[model samples]
Structures are given as C-alpha cells and as structure tokens.
Target: MYLFILLPVILYILIRKKSFKKVLRLHKVSPQQIFITMLLILAIQPMTALAARIMEHLLGHGFFPPMGDMSANGSGNLFMSLFIIAVTPAICEEVFMRGVVLDGYRHIPLWKTAIMNGVLFGLFHNNFMQLSYTSIVGIILTYVVVFTNSIYPAILMHFVMNALSVLMEKYPTSLYANFTIWYETNMVLLILLAIVSICATILLLIWLKRLSNNSAIESMDASDNSIEASDALNHTITFVEWPLMLATAISVIYSLMMVYAM
Candidate 1:
C-alpha cells in the first residue's frame, strides 16, 4: 500500500511536468455528487458479484484462493482490520491507479482511459478471482473520477466497499450461518433484494449517463480553447511505448503463472 503511493510520487517528480494536484485530480465535488457516488456503488455491488461469479466459472476454482490467508488468521481487532484492509488500500491504491496511472492516459478518450485503467488495475491484483471484479470496480471508479473531476468520490467508494468486505470476512462463519438461516426463512426477501439490485443498478447507470453528459456540456461551454487542446492531446500511442507495454506484459505473465501454479 505504501509503495503504491510512494512509487507514483517518485515517478511524478522524475517525469511528469504537470503539477501533482492536476495529475492526481485533487479537486472538489459537490455533496450531492458524493451522495450519488455512494448510491452508484450500492447499486453496482450485485453486478460486481455477478462478474466475479462469471470469472470463477470461466477460470475454475483452482485459479483463485482466498487472498492472504485472512480466513485462517483473522485480524481480531476491528480497527486494525479496517486500517489494513480498507483505509490503506482506499488511499494508496487510488493514489497509484486513479491518480497516477489513469492520469498518465488522460490525453486519450475517457472511455478508453477508463478501460485501460480497469485492465491495469485487474492485472495489478495478479489473481484471477479479483481481476474481473476489481477491473469492473476500477472502471466505475475511473468514470466517477473523470465525471466529477475529483478523487474523493472514488476513495470514499473504495473505502466503503473494502470496509464491507472486512466485515464479511471478519465473521465469516457467523455471517454464513445467519445467511443460511435467513435464506431458508426469507427466500422471498432474497429474491426481492436481487430484483431491486438489478433495477437500481440500471437506474443508476442512466442517472450517471445524464450527469456525465451535462458535465461535458458545461465543460465545453466553459472553454473552447481547452477543448481544442484536449482534442490535440487525444492522439493514440503505439506499443512501442516500452514502459507501459513491459509493465502490462509482466503483470499478465505473472498472473497467468499464478493461475496455472494453483
């Protein structure tokens, strides 16, 4: 976690001409925007699980084991668990992925940038199980950062999601027991929740699209000169960009090795 932040800062100092604030998108967003970001994350939770299940089915069980033996030796302390699993990654990974790496590709179209950011994030995990879901989450976080023009929303969303995971893992046996009983007792409610999640997710995407469109229009109106510069900067690059290509290749190769070795 510390390395993520530190490496990015070092690279920025050595290479990037832009100020850290601009590169990292340390801008402000409205309270309502933050609330919407939270709602969007809630809506997407079911979809993320679905993506993970799909990946697991395609890759098979052997490809992914529980990360870090968290189940065998649980954190025991709630605050420590939260600090290790939630707070640290929320800050460090976001700083590295969304702040440094995503910013490196900002000259490209937003969708392409988001997709690349997602893929890189997935590979960064070096595990099949996490790759699919984390990629999806990364794309969503990238979109949120780009649309809101701020990093706080992504950080908050990451923290919330990680905190939930920590809770789930911290008391897995208890949670599983309660879930089994609840499923047996309230199958109808479970179905309803699933249906609601699907519907809410669709609605949130529509809402986000409209919000993004409005923001784009406002940005265009605000500066024609900036738009021209943005367009000029949006040209494609080749794989001859050795640094990016090499990093991507290494990540993919290592992940494949881990998968097969399992």
Candidate 2:
C-alpha cells in the first residue's frame, strides 16, 4: 500500500511534469455512469472466470497460492478484510497504474494506451495466474477511466471486484456450491453462460463508447482549439521506449521465477 503511494509520488516529482489532478483524473463522474460501470463489470465476471480457467488448463498449472488467506487464517473481522483487501488496493493501485502510468501515455492512441496500461498492471502483480485475468480487468478499467474522464469509476469497480473475491473466498462452498456442481455437470450450460456474459459485455462496451463520444463532444465545445486538435489525430505506438521494455521484461522474468519456485 505504501509503495503504491510513494512510488507514484516519487515518479511524478522526478519525471511527470503534468499536474497531479490531471494525471490522476480526479474528476467527478455522474451516478449513472458509475452504475453503468458497475453493471459492465458484473456482466463480464463469468467471461473472465472462463478465460482464467482456459489459461490455467493450457498452462497445466493452478494459480499460485494467494499471499494471504483470510478464511484459512480465521480472520473473521469483516471491516479489516474489507479495508485491507478492497479499499487499500483500489486506492493505491489506481493511483499508480491508472493515474501516473496512464498519464504518461496520454499522447498515444486510446486503445494502445489502455492495452499498455493493462499489461503493466498485470505484470505489476508478479504472478502468472493473476496476469491473465487482471490484465483483462485492467483494460476494462482503463477504458472506463478514459471514457468517463474520472478515476472514481475505476476505483469503485476495483473495490467491488476485490470485495466479491473476498466474499467468495469466505463462503466458497456455501455461496457457489450449487452453481459449481451445475457447471461441472452441464457443459452446455457453462458454455451458454460464458457466451451470454461475453455478449452482455460487448453491448455494454458499445453503450460506453457512445457515452464517451458524447463526453468528448462536450469537452471539445468547452475546451480551446489546441485540445480539440490534439484529440483529432491518432498517435502512433512509439511510446514503448527502452526503459519501459527493460522493466517489463524484468517483471515477466520475476513472475516466471516465482511461479516455478512455488
């Protein structure tokens, strides 16, 4: 938690010349936009799970053991768990990944920016198991931040996702036993569920794109000509300089070592 805050602050001071407010996108979002983001996240959960499972099967290995196990440790304090697992990560990770790192790539195309942000966020975990799904979630969160022009939605979504993970861990058998059994017994149902979730996610993305377009139009009307002209051109993907490539390579190597060591 501390590193997340400190590292970003240090980087901002040393490298990023942009204002913290602009870099962090600490703007307000409408209640409706928050609701839509939440819905989109919920709709994509099943698909993400399926993707993770497929990745696990292809790799022939299970996920690395979690650093901490709340249930196993008998950490029955709900408030503490929520604070540590959900709130801290939502605030700290967003400040670093979506705030500082993302701002550094503002000159690039939005899609490229989002993908790079997601990849960096995934590698930041330093675990192969989390890299796949977390990257996907990161991409979605990046899109949300870009479209809404606010970090609050990304923070909220991250919190909700982490909270759900905590809850599922706490009540794994009780909460999902029936669904797990049904899924195992009925392949068709599992496939259908994945398909439906993916379709819903796609539709929500389309809706979000429309909302982003409207927001961009409003921003253009309110802003100066320089901003409008900057938005008009798509930037090339030359943002991956040597330093970034070296850091990413190191992260991947570290993650592989950790995975094998486990």
Candidate 3:
C-alpha cells in the first residue's frame, strides 16, 4: 500500500522537472573527513546496545522503540526495512514534507521553514525514541533537501543508510563489522555522523553562499518578473484532477494498512 501510494507521486515530481542532477557526494568525502563524520555514529552504537542491555539486565526491562520492530535476525525483515526506511519514505516524505509543505511554507523564511518542517517530519514518525533520532535525521535530511534544492541526494543518503543496515544485519561480524553494528544501533554512527554532518554542512553552506554570489544556485534574470529560481512556483498541477485525488485516497488506505500491520 505504501509503495503503491507513493510511487506515482514522486514519479510525478521527477517528471515535473525536465532534467534532474546530483547535488552532493559523501563518499568522495575525503578519508580525513570520513573519520570525522562517521566516528561518532560508529562509536555510539555499541554503547547504546550495552546501555540498554545493562538497564534490562538490572531492571528486567529492555526498552525499544514502539514503532521500530528491528532485530538482528528477523525473517524477511531486511527487504522490508530497506524499502520502508529508504526508498518509499525518501520519495514520499521528500515530496510531501520538504518539497510540497516546506515549499508551500516558503512564505516563511527559508531557514525557519527548514527547521520547523524538519521538526514536524521528526514528529510524524510518532514514537518517543524515534522522536529524537528522527528529528536529528529529519533536520539533516531537510538541510540536504534545502542544500541541493533537489531530492536525489536525500534519497541516495536514505537508501544507503537503510540498505547498509540490511547488509550489516546479514553479515554481522566481519573485520569492519563495527560499521554495521554502529548503524544497527544508530547512536554509534551518530557521533561520527554528527561531526561529519557538521563539517559537510559548513562546506555545503559555503558552497551555497558561493553559488549565491555567482547566482549559480539560484539564478536571476535581468527582469524582476523573471526570477529564474526553481523556488519560484512558475508551474503547478493545481487542476484538482482525479488522479491527484485518487492518489491521495490510495495513500490514505496504504497508510492505514501499514499501521494496521504494525
């Protein structure tokens, strides 16, 4: 249901733009920077598990996210987690949350819109444990959406993050098994992720500023009527067509099924 509902909508967005392109590359993230960005996220995972284990060990309480039924060896869980965590959410969420709503709210300041909507995205997860983690991630994702002014980077990052989780779970103990475990327990990766995110953000900001100076990121024309920025809502499919409403209905039903299944 989730897939059925979201596939068309994002496809519509992709089709909206005559062409699409990449924004940022984290892998090309120099070795020195990788260490900085990935260190904290990698380190904290084990501690989170260990802490939770210790708490349960002492108090007979193993607390987990109500919304997250993740485990090391759950059957068929890998693909499920991959799609749920990565692809579907990436497209649908980016479109609705960052693309549509945030864009609509451009009436507010951009930074303010990014922050406020990102917090809303986090809360949309509807879980206490996930609230903090997803909020952090939501903010990061929102910034990337804002940074690139495109959703592809967010989708790529989201897909990689989720697919990596599946890969690590399958091959749990290896020479670099630490990385896998780090993601399974998100906190481990978060420390390094935070540092890297911060640095990347600073770099990205500088890049955006440079682009602005050159009018590369958001180009302007000679005429005030022609603000050549994509941010300008020059075109929109606001006909209230049947497909749009049908898609919305399908999305609601799909959401209901997912919640029902959970």
Candidate 4:
C-alpha cells in the first residue's frame, strides 16, 4: 500500500521534468522550525486520540482493532514492525500527500489547500474511524509542511506519531502509559488536557506560520519577479474532477459497510 501510494507521484514528477528536490521540498529548515514542529505534533496527540475515541463510540468498538502487538520480545521483530508501520508510511505517505497533492493545489489559497489536502488524506485511509482523527492530523501535517516549506518536518511528524505508539506499547510502564491510563479514566481531565494542548498547538502553528511568511517575503524580494513566476503563482483551476469524486464515493461506501457489518 505504501509503495502503491508513492510510485505514481515519483513517476509524475519525472514525466513533468520537475526537480525532485523542489517537488518534495527537500530543502533545509531552521532549528526553531524543527523544534516547533516536534512540539506541535506532540501537542495534538491527546486531541487526536479524543477524536478517535469519539469516532469509535459512534461507529462501535473494535471497528478497526490493532492487528497484533508491535511490542514483540525480539529486537528483530520490533524493528521490522517499526519499519513496516512507521518508516514506510512516513516516507511514502508524506511524499504523496505533502509532496505531490499539495503541489497540485498550490494555486488555491493556503487554508483551502490545507483543508482540502487534509480531507483527501483522511479519505485515502478508507477507514471511517481513522477518518475522524487522521483528518485532524492531516490538517496539522499539511500546515507543518507548508510553514516549514520542507517535507522532512512532515515526515518526522508522521514517524514520531507512529513510532511513539510502538515504543509506548513496548514499554507498558512508561510515563506515557501511566498518563493514558489516568486520562482515559478521568473524563473531565481528558477534556481539559485536550483543550489545553489544542490551544498550544494552534499558538505554535501561528508562530511557525509567521516565521514562514517572513522567509517567503524575503525570498520574493531576492528573486526576479518574472512573468512566468507571477503567472504560476496566480494561476487558478477547478479542483473538482472525476477521479477524486469516484474515490470519495468508494471510500464512503466501503467505510459505511465496514462500520455496519461489525
């Protein structure tokens, strides 16, 4: 599935003769941006968990249970699980989402691009329960990519989220596990923590965006404002197409069946 998601994006870049570096935004970002991206990713987790819980409650429990524990005893199995669950999706999914899909929507306004990309990303998962929280994660991931103007931050975000789950499961007595136990038991505290973390995430994102905007302005000032460049930035196009519509319909129908069947 990871390769299936990524291969077409690579081929499209090659066929279009676009620079891989530019398409993937492989340029470096500042330490400050990297730090904030890490914090933003961590801060949003509780809220995302809450969203997923709410979705499960609505869809019924065990709708999408974990296939098996990633916390196997052997180091070999652990590494393999991490590679399959975390690393592969982090690279492949980020390339498709933030790399190609985002570049395709560059003509749209920033917020529009982020929201649409996020929604499409959630649907791409084809799981109703995941769609609830992954959409939220996707929006934040898009913002991280956009603000940093580098795909690496988004890749890190994806890896950290998945890897943490694997590691925390491996070490059940970890601080994160203790916190999860308490948080799940206390409804009020869970709500309060989620709200606080969400606010922090927004503040951090705004700061990152401010820094990104400053950098963008400086770059524009340094560049020759060629007609071609201006046209590319100003270009607009209809976002609705048959492929996306078809995919959305299929995912919706499949998710509905799964939700009700179980």
TM-score of each: 0.72, 0.76, 0.54, 0.80
lDDT of 3 by residue, 69-131 (tens): 553224457676666655666666655555544444433344544566556665565544444
lDDT of each: 0.67, 0.70, 0.49, 0.73
Output the lDDT of residue 45, model 2.
72
| Predicted structure 2: lDDT | 0.70
- Clash-forming residue pairs, model 2: none
Best by lDDT: 4
lDDT of 2 by residue, 18-83 (tens): 677787888887767877898987787767767677777778887535625643333777667878
If the candidates were sorted by their TM-score against the true structure, best first, what order would they fall in? 4, 2, 1, 3
lDDT of 4: 0.73
lDDT of 1 by residue, 66-173 (tens): 534543334477777788778887887787777867666654556667788888788787666788889988888887777777788899999998877766666657
**By descending lDDT, how would the candidates be arranged?**
4, 2, 1, 3
Candidate 3 residue 8 Cα shift, in angstroms, is: 9.2
Per residue, candidate 4 scores C-alpha lDDT tens digits across 21-75 of 8878888989999899889877997788778777877887853346364334234
Candidate 1 Cα RMSD after full superposition onto the native fold (Å): 5.7
Off by over 4 Å in 1: 14-17, 62-68, 71-75, 173-199, 205-234, 238-262
